[model samples]
Every structure is written in structure tokens, then in C-alpha cells.
Target: MSHHTLPRPGASVFVYEWPVRLWHWANALFILVLIVSGWFIARPLPTMQIGEATHQFVMGYIRFAHFAAGQLLTVGFLGRIYWAFVGNHHARQAFYLPLWQKSWWRDVLHEARWYAFLESRPGIHVGHNPLAQIAMFLFMVVGMTFMIVTGFALYAEGAQRGSLPDQLFGWLHDALGNSQLMHSLHHLGMYFVVIFMTAHIYLAIREDIMSRQTMVSTMINGYRSFKDDDAA
Candidate 1:
């Protein structure tokens, strides 16, 4: 479950705390690094005979970047989960759905209408709107978990038998019974994360421009400022 605070119109509320903001930007950077390096790892550059073949390690560097980012992302996600327990109410929003509450469902529909242009004004939200909440749950929480599991499983294969990665996540390979299939699935999962990132950026900019409250700056400075005096 999650909670929301209703602030007076034209008031500025501290919504995202420092830890949340740091995780937001750091997660973005880590995902960006992972995506670029993962692509190159899938289709490496042609061999350049400029240096001794033994000395050239272009693919090695790319894989290292990918692996490092993956590990960082995993640790960051775990910390986010821990923060969900100890931080403010908003910090827990991404982890669960309040499906039993009719008000939550109504707000979800209201947000959908606003996004669809059926409504001129959006409802004020101190943290994520219901639609954005659901999106984050799906794309960031569930999607990231899927990627991490599959990613480490793939890494385990390269690490070989009796390695830490193999011990921790290698069962995934046995469960799937085909390494190429795992590769394909992991590649497909990357596209989903990319799609989410693109849509998230577009929506943040759109809301900042059209909504009556802060959007992008809230994530940066942790305060959500209302643009008008009308009460929700």
C-alpha cells in the first residue's frame, strides 16, 4: 500500500527526498550505460589490426561496462526496495498496487482521460499520478527484476561452472534449457526498458508543460510546486 499527501493549491510540497532523487538519476545513468554496452556486446565492432590481437580489448571493455552497470543497477534496486520500507510514503508507490480501492481506480481513469486529451486539466498529485504509479510498477519494478534475473543468468554462463554468478542465478539456464532463448528474451526485455524510458521522458516533459504543477523539476529539487490557486 501507498499514501498520498494533499497540499493546498499554489503550495510547494517536498515530495521526493534526496535518496529518491539520487536513485532516479543514478538509475537513469546506469540503464543508459547498460543499453549502449549491451548493444555493442551483441554486435561487436570489426577487428582492427592496429594493435596486437592480444592487446586489443574493445569487446572486453564493452562487456566490462555492461557487467559493472548491471551490478550497480542491481544494488541500487535493492536499496530502493529497502528505502521503500524506511523512507516517505511516496517511496513505496512503485512496489505495489492499491487495486482494492475504488478511489485509486477512479483516479487511474481520470489520469487516463487527461492523457488521452479528453480532459483539459489534470488532477494535482504530490507524487506520481495513478497512471504514472502503475507505469513505474510495471516498467521499473517488475521489468527491472526480470532483466536482472535474466542478465545475471546470462552472465553466469560466461562465468562457467562453480562461479558465484553461476551459483546464484545459473538455475535459470537449466530451467529454460536453452541459452540462445535466454539471450533472445533478455534482448527483448532491453527493448521494453528502452520503450519505458522514452515514454517516461516524453510524459515528464508533457506534464511539465501542460499540467498545473511541477513535473521534471520535482525530481531534481524534490519539491512539487503548484502553478495555480484552485483547489483540487
Candidate 2:
């Protein structure tokens, strides 16, 4: 090993703990359920006379799935926030950015360049890289909050004017002045999540193959293993 380096090849760091791993997979499953059910809710299936009309209740089940998954997602997000405080440093990475740090910003630019194919190698990171930190803060943190708020706000409409959901989230309709507008914004936010997920998967797989360390398995096993210690 080099004098500046602490370990040799195959050295690993315990980055993501069990709680973070569980939450990550659970959150992904919830998002998948929400997306599929929410899609059907947005553009429902054709009216099919299957058995009795009252017994069919197709759309009812879809909406219920969406709502149930949304509730689970909301609870999971809250748990994730709590874990951010008590879990490891890597667990807290998605929630904030160290904007005042010069080196951090420099690494962000470096990673951006690497993503753009302007750089040949990636910067090694035990947790998320600087650019990924920003993306997580924006998409997962801010975007999930937006979806949950608007989703419940829309749900509050169907939940009646005096129910608990309406009492907690009805202000959103008044704040926007038009419930339809709120729906449009919430629908648009789903696309943002889809885009971020696509990019995230591609980058993780690419880095696993081309970069100097493990990527996908890191989340599964909670160990970020380095292939070589050469600096980026």
C-alpha cells in the first residue's frame, strides 16, 4: 500500500447499516407500488362488466392500493428521517449538503464531468459522491416530501371535508386556490422521481463496472469494497 493510503486492495468499509438497507429496499418497493397504482388511478381501465357492478370495484381497489402504498411510504420516510439522526454518517447523506465546503463543490464538478464523459475516472466515495448528495437532497428528500403532501392533499378531497386527512391537508387546496392545479403539480413530480431513478440505476451500474469499487452490492451487503487504491 502507498504511504498515504490506509489499506490494500479488497479493503472494505461498513457504510450502510441494516436499517438503512431495509429502508432503501422498502422505500423502492413502496414507490413501485405507488407508481403502478397511481398510474391506473390517473388513467383508469375500461369499464368491464365482470360479475355484478358492486362486486367489481376495480377502480376502488386501485385507489386503495395507491393510498395504502402512499401511507406506507410516508411512514417509511419518517423512519428514514429518524434514522438519519441516529444511524451512521452515510445514513444522513441524503438529507443535507455541505454547500460551504470548497472541496465538496469541486468533487461535484468532477463527478459531473465524469458523468458527462469529460472525465475518465470517478471520485471514490464511501457514501454517496458529492453530486449524488445533491441529487438525493433534491429528489428523494424534497421530491418525496412534495409527493406525500400533494398526494394526501388530493386524498383529502375524497376523504370528505371534515375528515382527518382533510383537516391536516386541506389548506393545500386553499393555498393553490385550485385542486386541479395541485393535482397537476403532483403528477409532474412523479416524472421527476422516475427520471432520477433511471439516472441513479444507470450510474450505479456504470460505476460498478467501470469505476474502482463495488456499487449495487454495497447497498445489499452494506460494505463498500475498493478494487484498487489509485487516486482519482
Candidate 3:
């Protein structure tokens, strides 16, 4: 008698949507290009006229692309924010919350130990690991806030002296001391973004290597191959 093999006990039921994946990679590329171009504009270290003109042109293009990409990223951010409130348990608070403080702390320590090569198993998670969750949240806040403030500042510069944009950011400009200060703050924030981006890519690559699963691919495909018994 022929025997039938049962299907796998459990498999991923949820996957990332096209919009989410597109937003992720597109935003990543846009931010990288923006950062590189922005840095040269902020500080022309090599002091070459040709480089300066090229930098200006590149930065101009980057600013336009950044604005367009920012809009797309904003849409993705808002959609995800809305989803957080109404999505499934896995996609809602569970994904954002730290599980339990003790558990999360333990996991944090486990991560530290794992990085130090002190733990044998080091525990893998399906969703963002605790450290990643926190960093991601911070990036979202800093990135969005910086974009809003700096964007308004730029708009204010082109507005009539007493117009709304001017009025709104005028005090901020004064408090910060000048347009130069605003520019500096905006530029500094990009450094934070770059640091976050570096860590994010490194961790994703590390996880993919260690787990034999594409951590980056999850953002693309939305579905990760989680173990049957893994908790959401």
C-alpha cells in the first residue's frame, strides 16, 4: 500500500506586499544616493571647482529624487502605521512591542553574547529581533522628523517674508541661530541615518548568513520561512 506524506505542519501565511517591498528598496537606494551627494555639498574637502560644480549638480538631482522618494516613503510609513493599529497580531503591537521586558532584556543580552560568540544557540527570531525593533523605530522617528523640519525650512526660504512657511519655521530658524544652523542640523541627521543604514545592512546580511534565510528577501517577499513552532 502506498502511504501519503502529510503536508508540512506549519508554513508562513503572511507575506510582504508589493508596495511595501518597493518602498523599502527604493527608499534605501534613494537615501544612500542622497547621503553621498549631501555630504559633498556640506563639505567640499577636496576643494576642486569641477568637483564643486559636479557636487552641486548631483546634490540638486538628489534633492529632487529625495523629495519624490520621501513622498513614497511617507505613504509607506502611513500605511504601516495604520496597519499597526488594525493588522493581525503578528503585524500589530507584537511586532512593535518588546515582548516582555525581562524576555526582551534577556534576548538583548543573548544578542550581545551571540555577537561575542559566547552562546551556543543564540536564539533566532522570525520578526525583528529586539535590538533591531528599537533601532528601526528610532530611525523612523528621526528620519521623518528631520525630513519634515528641514523640508519646511527649505520651503520657508522661497516663501514671502511673512508667509506661513516663513512664519512657522522663522522662530526655529532664529532659535537655531540661522539658516546655517538649520543646514547643519539637517546635515548631521543624515549622519545618524547613515549609521543606522550601515548597521541595518550588516545585521541583515549576518542573519541571512547565519540562518540560511534571506533576511533581505523577507522585505522583498514579505514572507519569511519561520519554523512551525516559532511565535509571531
Candidate 4:
């Protein structure tokens, strides 16, 4: 379709909803807190003795915060997942899989061309950009899977051998060589999430600066104003 055929600014696009926006920013905050606390828990300072009361106190607080943030994260994730099926057409399809290889390739080239400065304007997108869509879906899967596995591993460490968490993580433990391996996988998953978060923030800022659009405000107000002639 020609760019001119696309909806113009003030075309009455109903993009985001308040609940989705709330869930997004809330989840972002929880994830950030979890990442920081998790790092300290994983590697304590050399000067801090592990068996000391002070060390225990710090570790205990970290564990508490991590679990609390985890609960909030799970709630936000489930809400967004539910919205994916029931939300507006744009939200439902924003991060959906590309069914046509031709369209996918076209979008890929368009993205590359834009990035390379070969295109003078951004591409028109009713939903997420092709790359954002793929990254969102992948991150959802990876994040959810990591949370489940890591949660079970942590639970198993405290529960009886025949308890639910222990039983659930047993096969995973065997396959990965033990709980230690599961911990490593969980930690590595954080790196992926960190990378995604960094890129997401950078792109949002870049778009806001270049386009004079409130990329961050969209998450707060559930609306992003764009020129009808704007590429996206």
C-alpha cells in the first residue's frame, strides 16, 4: 500500500488502553527492581561475610523484595496476555507473528533501509514495527519460561523432596545436570531481558526526540498523537 493511502493524523486511532499502560510501566519498574536486588543476592561483596548477621539481613531483604516484585510481574504478565486476545485490533495484532513471508521480507528491508538512512521517512505501521513485534513475542516466551523454571528451582530448595516444586523441577534438574544449571539459565535469561530493556528505552527516546511524539506518554495516557502523514 502507498504511504499516502494510510490513515492521516487525527484519524481517530484507538491505540492503547489504561490497563495495558498501567501494567506495562508497573512491570517495567518491578523488573528493574528485581534485576538489581537479584544481582546483589547472587554475588555478595567480598568484605561481607556470608554468615554474619548483617549479611543475612541484607540477603533476607533482597529475597523478600525479589519475591514481592516477582508476584507483581506475574500479575502484570497475565493481564497483558489476557488483553492480547481481548484488546483492540491493534493491540491484539501488535506483536503477532507474520503469516506472509513476502510481507515479512518487505518489512525487514524497510526497517533496514530506514536504519541505514536510505529512506528519508519512517515506515507506516499500524501496530508494532516488525522487529519490535518479534522481539516482544520472543521476550514473552523466554521471560515466562525462565520465571517458571527459576521459581520452581527456588521453591524446591526449600520444600520437601516430594513436594510440588521439587517434583516439577526434577526433570529439568536432571536434564540440565542439577539445580545449579537451572540457576545459571535463570541468570542468563536476565541478560537477554536487560538487552531488550536497553534497546527498548533507547528506541523510545530516539523516536520521541526525532518525531516530537511522546513515546513515553503513550504508556501513561494510552494515546500517541501522530501526524497523518507521519511514517508511523
| Backbone clashes, each candidate | 0, 0, 1, 2
Residue runs of model 1 more than 4 Å from their true location after superposition: 1-5
Please give the lDDT score for candidate 4.
Answer: 0.69
lDDT of each: 0.91, 0.87, 0.63, 0.69
Estimate, for each residue in 129-187, the C-alpha lDDT of model 3 and write its tens digit.
Answer: 66676776677555656765685675577565799878886667777778877887788
lDDT of 1 by residue, 115-191 (tens): 98998878878778889999999999999999999999999989999999999999999999999999999999999
Candidate 3 backbone collisions, by pair: 16-222
How does each model score on TM-score? 0.96, 0.94, 0.72, 0.83
Question: Which scores better on lDDT, 2 or 4?
Answer: 2
Candidate 4 lDDT tens digits, 94-181: 4467657677768767867776789777666555666666777777555655765676676577665888768877566767777777
TM-score of 1: 0.96
Rank by lDDT, descending? 1, 2, 4, 3
What RMSD, rounded to one decimal, does every model reach? 1.8, 2.5, 6.8, 3.3
- Model 2 stretches with alpha carbons more than 4 Å out: 1-7, 229-232
Candidate 1 or 3, higher TM-score? 1
To one decimal, what is the Cα RMSD in angstroms of model 1 from the true structure? 1.8
In Å, residue 153's CA in model 2 sits off its true spot by 0.6
Q: What lDDT, from 0 to 1, does candidate 2 have? A: 0.87
Error of model 1, residue 200, in angstroms: 0.1
Maximum-TM-score candidate? 1
